[model samples]
Target: MNKKVMSIAAMVAGFGPSAYSLADSQHDEAIERGQAHYLLFCANCHGVDADGNGPLVELLKVTPTNLTTLRSSGSEATVAERVLQAVDGRHAVGESAERKMPVFSDNLEISTVIEIAAYLDSIQK
Candidate 1:
């Protein structure tokens, strides 16, 4: 093939759907891991649908944040970064000096935190 033809073909190949597929794979994987962890740790408070209406709501002094609205809630940070901070307990809700959200920074791996964040981001409205 001519140089121009070869270059065009290369460009087209580089822009193919495989790139999107790879990204989608990684995104799906993260979401899967995140969902599992959320179910195990957060579902008791955050709810399976992450609507802040978990079964334990009545037992807690503070209501869990409705995670479905995080993206549209006018927060400056992206959903993932916000979740990371929250999991680390750096983003407390009220000034009560006692945070209801348990800090997972000590027990969970950072990668696990990121995966949980990824899952939360996927469910945003």
Candidate 2:
């Protein structure tokens, strides 16, 4: 079994004979991977805090969107879906003469994009 399942089983076996807790191991793993990817590819423009105040923000013509408030922005789509679209270059949050954010569709794997979305979703306020 995977480490996640093993750990959860250990907790159940050790904590109580017939007691157990639910955990989405895949989601947790995705978030971890997403955070690492975000730090590597997005932090320069989106900030480590994801507040759109990264070191390279001033250099761009358009400011990056603050990711923490995305879910509360009243969009019909779920935060994860919106993030997926944005990263895939299918949805532009702030369209100008030219989009400042590069299209990551070709650069990142689909699973990687989903993981990034998962991470973004976890941080939404």
Candidate 3:
């Protein structure tokens, strides 16, 4: 290929991943923020390490889930969907009256929930 044509191709390829990287970096930032949120609210039950070994686990009748392995077991999209649903109360309401998990819909903003989902996505085993 001519030098000019090769240069053009290089530019095009560079531009593509640049756009994707920008968005990917933004998503990474969201995940970091979500981890912070999880620590503040969920860490009590999910554990600071996110291994479902939170200090409060002994007090609860039901066992907490291991947050780290969520992605390894399922698609990232499905994990995020489930997390968002539970945070928003859609999953909570569907559960029986003896729900152990608190519905964050009333307390957490949508952005916060999204951040948490992103964080969970990054930490998956």
Best by TM-score: 1
Candidate 1 lDDT by residue in tens digits, 49-125 = 99999999999888999999987988765666567667767664555656668888789876676677767767778
Candidate 1: C-alpha RMSD after superposition: 11.7
- Roughly what TM-score does model 2 have, to 2 decimal places? 0.75
Root-mean-square deviation of every model: 11.7, 9.8, 12.0
Writing each residue's lDDT as its tens digit, candidate 3 over 3-45 gives: 5324433432332335465576766667788889999989999
Weakest ten-residue segment in model 2 by summed lDDT: 11-20
Tell how far residue 15 is off in model 3, in angstroms.
19
Give the C-alpha miss distance for residue 43 in model 2, angstroms.
Answer: 1.0
Q: Candidate 2 overall Cα lDDT vs. reference? A: 0.70
Candidate 2 clash pair list: none
Candidate-wise lDDT, in order:
0.73, 0.70, 0.67
| Colliding residue pairs in candidate 3 | none
Stretches > 4 Å off in candidate 3: 1-20, 74-77, 92-98
**How much is 57 displaced in model 3, in angstroms?**
0.5
Judge candidate 3 against the unseen true structure and give its global Cα lDDT, from 0 to 1.
0.67
- The regions of model 1 sitting more than 4 angstroms off are 1-21, 92-98
Predict model 1's lDDT versus the native. Answer: 0.73
